[model samples]
Target: MTQDPQTSSDASGAPASSRRGLSRHLVDIAPLKASPAFARLWIGGAISGVGAFMTTVAVGLQIYEITESTFAVGLVGGIALVPMIAAGLWGGVLADVFDRRKVVIASSLASWASILALVVLAFWEQHLQGLGTHAPVWPFYLVTTVNAITSTVSNATRGSVVGRILPADMLSRATALNGISFGAMVTVGPALAGVLAASIGLPWTFAIDAVLFTAGFLGIWMLPSLPRLGERVEAGWPVLKEGLTFLRRSPNIRMSFIVDAIAMTFGRPYALFPALGALVVGGGALTVGALTAAGAIGTMLTSLFSGRIAHVHRHGIAISRAIQVFGAFAVLFGVFTWVGMHSGHAAGEGWGGTDFSTLALMALAMAGMGASDELSAIFRQTMIIQAAPDEMRGRLQGVFIVVVTGGPRLGDMYAGALAAVTALWFPPLLGGFVIIALIVILTRAQRAWREYDATSPTP
Candidate 1:
């Protein structure tokens, strides 16, 4: 039998006598040992992801501080939607046309520059406050929107490069490892943002993100050049149309996006964290950070012990089931928030005054959401990476990014708008049910999607 490249090498990159031992339940780390380049990319991306998420939390907090309104906080995502969509589409085409390494490097630089801009604006805001003047909020929105665009390009290109670097058998394992990257990003990042913002200020918080971004730069810089594999599509509406055309004909891929859209649109409750912390759950910035990190904790744990799942071939059913569980957790989160609000807990002091019991319950619910969501994401990503042709992978990943990023923004709007009219708890309660109902309907309508097998991906 032909020796697989993965098991052919030991940690020293020498020939090995036998395959490395693997735990049945722990995450498979063979992919890392097999490819040094991927390991670097993964580590760099994880570290940078931490910083990026920090900036995310800071920006949201900064907006909330300026406006003191949940809708305004949610508007941050709403404002970036169109530009981000354009960036995903354009970036996808760029990835398909240019050297993917160069595309990622350029986009990463732009994203880092945007973070620096945030640092500058943050300092400017501090200076203004000293003079009894308020800095304009538009700058924050503008900078974050630009960051969103650049990051989308960088991310889509990076995602596309994964399949190129690793063999098909390893894609699922790599995707699971990505969950760890995401976990680090969200779990450590937001929590640190809260501490830093509370202890130092927003300027320094933004500055730290700027500093940490360099690690990601190094990772992308070291990658081998990856150019188009076949006839490169022109970077324009035509290329986009081609991608859309592909999607229209591919039911499995289409259903994956659809199911994820349903989950993110209704089940996402992130936009409400600021308000929930301030008025409902009453822990302030600390509460917000904890709430955000809780989901990542669940994600990290799920990824940690994903060994058995890597062997599973029934991806479509796994995705559907995972998302349904996510919806249930979202509903539980709402329930906890409702109970906390009725319990008459006053807004606590910054980080120290949180209602620990109530916060714990809510965090548990959020963690459940994170675990289920990550499971579904793992399968969805694996299907895309394995099923799509190499030439079309970039474009397909672009559409995937749109759904991944856009769905949450729409959810932000939904949560924000609904909360604006009703109580803070109503949106998630209703949205959760909506998510469950829609997933059931959508899953039933597409039998092919439900029966999609990982071994024979049909995108």
Candidate 2:
């Protein structure tokens, strides 16, 4: 039998040295060197992502400021959920059948328009006061839902484009790079949004996102047209059914989705950050930004030192373990919040009035969760890209996007609802344990998933 290139010795066939150089752990730039198109897309996305995140933070703040309700804030995700789901399924079909480049460009334009609409609403609320003392929150939800739908489609197309652009071996490195991109956006975007919203105002903060969106166009414009790889099918249920059928057959891929859904649904704590900063941790917007950025900090560090991730042959085991670690950290975060509540530390008044000690502990726990989540993301994405057939990549990627994005929305609902009824800390504390138990049970039931190997590309 031929030795697997991933684990085999060099041409000499001698045992490979176990000692990889220190440089092995750093962010691999080889993918950038190999594909200029991918590099451009990556850089453009990174630039635009910061602006997008700023908008995200600003919207949450605006909603909270208007209503002072965590449930209202969480409803943002709920409103977007169904539309995003439809877009994911339909968009995957579009990506597979139509020109992916065009699909991305069109979706990007829609997303840009949504951001611009937000900009208009923000300005209107500040100067016109058209809807009363506070801006009508419904419009915010309407525009963000549109943005979510378009962005979800755009993401599925973009992910498909990556597989077409890069070689199979480079997929893992590319996944790592993608993690770094996300980490950068999550870290810088929220922080910038907080500072911008706090200093200038919400209108200007949203305007920045609208302005930054232009960068994405530049990257997509440069890409060569990418047509469908298989027999072109109409963009309808038939196309979606085909993809679903494939997923049903692919146990490893299905398991990947299931595990991710479990983690996101149970372990997501982001929806509570605004309330925590305002009512629990007490640094206001700044504290929210810090807590939000903490997870990205962990993600960034993990990606930076992800040198050894590419060598792991047992991707299934890695993904499972990483998610478990994420759950553990999430549980820890809940415990920290519970302790702070019991300690009777009054919530801080504003940005400067934070409970730093408790905030630090919570941030640390969130960071740990972020790091583990990123690790799991890297492996799961690599599995999807490498294991699935090229023709099915977009559809699978669409499902992946749904799981990735939809899971958090569900988490938002879970956290928001549970927090409204109980203490802010209860959801994650309960969810984390649920994640660990469900994942262990599910993985054990699916023997194939537990023993999955990257070299063979089973899914």
Candidate 3:
């Protein structure tokens, strides 16, 4: 029941008696006003996330353009999976063993260097095409894989440190704010990348992403030293083994991961976007950007009104219900895509002439999925961060990152492979049904997870 010294003051950094009333239904900004360090960290991550998302859209599009295969584009996530998992595991151990601030800064630099390499190769490819030969696709894959490895380390290190800076009561609010940041990243980044890639080209698009990454440096660099909080653990096999052992013992924490994997593995439809834009939905890159951004709009709207969620203590039930809604929306999205395909909409000039009516309906469905997913994520994150003890938080957070990230990679494969055999619409339609059924079965079987109460966290 002890609190973080950094969050000791009221969120406004004012004496409790003098504070004015704030809306309970709005996103609480107290975390920002209460701790200068958290504010800087949040700001830096928010700015940098925009650039990261931009790079994600650009990379996916580039691969699709090169191979003309949705499966190849989906392979981007599969390619990074093994390396990212290793980095996330070892990075968690490193976070627990060394200074977390330094770990993040080092990883950030490595990630930046990888992005710069992308910029160089992009321009080089442009030059090559102008003369005779085109640059090899292997280099792009290699650099992105390296970036994924570094990014996993940075994410694990940074995620583990948030608990050190914020009080337990504010954790929910902090997560909600992160949702807003995530919303902005997806909303702004993909849209901008689509415009830039269509107008300027990939070289400049990559260069802009490189420039934006600098903001993250200020966030991690300015944080106070964050060493391990409890019993010391070295980075080795024993530590990794210990982390897994703890997860085995904690059913609630374990269940959180399982449910998320179900939702992401079955419900995610991102891998289909490039193909939809190119063939089914038309408007190419613009359609891709709009479809991606549509989900963010829902995420942002949900987060903005998240003030009331902090009062809810039944996090497990809340997570279960939210993901069910997410599945329903996924099914809706599949229906829209199927309808658009059957309607025989003429392909536009890659940026315009999209079937606005069908696109709008699909975007609406995607937005619903985003909102529900964000709600589930807030509670899942809060549950993990709050339930785990100080010494084990790093490792648990690492696993959380793995589930959060790895599931999507697997989903990319699922969607890509299924779409390859069937049609783009079939994966989401069938997957959505699977997610809804699996979540219900899993939660019902895991009684402890279904009955988890936030007021008395068991992990």
Across residues 31-85, which tens digit of lDDT does each residue of candidate 1 receive?
A: 8987888999999999999999998888888888888889988888899999999
Clashing pairs in 1: none
Measured against the true structure, the TM-scores of the candidates, in listed sequence, are 0.95, 0.95, 0.94
Candidate 2 residue-wise lDDT at 92: 89
Query: Quick one: best lDDT, which candidate?
Result: 2
The models' CA-based lDDT, in order, is: 0.87, 0.88, 0.87
What is the C-alpha lDDT profile of model 3 across 308-341, one tens digit per residue? Answer: 6766888988999999999999999999989999
Model 1 misplaced stretches (Cα beyond 4 Å): 1-22
Better of 1 and 2 by lDDT: 2
Candidate 1's C-alpha lDDT?
A: 0.87
Worst 10 residues of 2 by lDDT: 10-19
Question: How many backbone clashes does every candidate have?
Answer: 0, 0, 0
Tens digits of per-residue lDDT, candidate 2, 1-459, equal 856545765322233353246765577777888899999999999989989988988899888988899999989988899989888888888899899999999999999999999988888777645545776789999999999999999999999999899888888889999889999999999998878887898899999998888887899989989998757668788889999999999999999999999999999888888888888778788887888899999998889888667678799989999999999999999999998777777887665667888999999998999899999999999999989988788899889898899999999999999999999889999999999998889878988988999989888
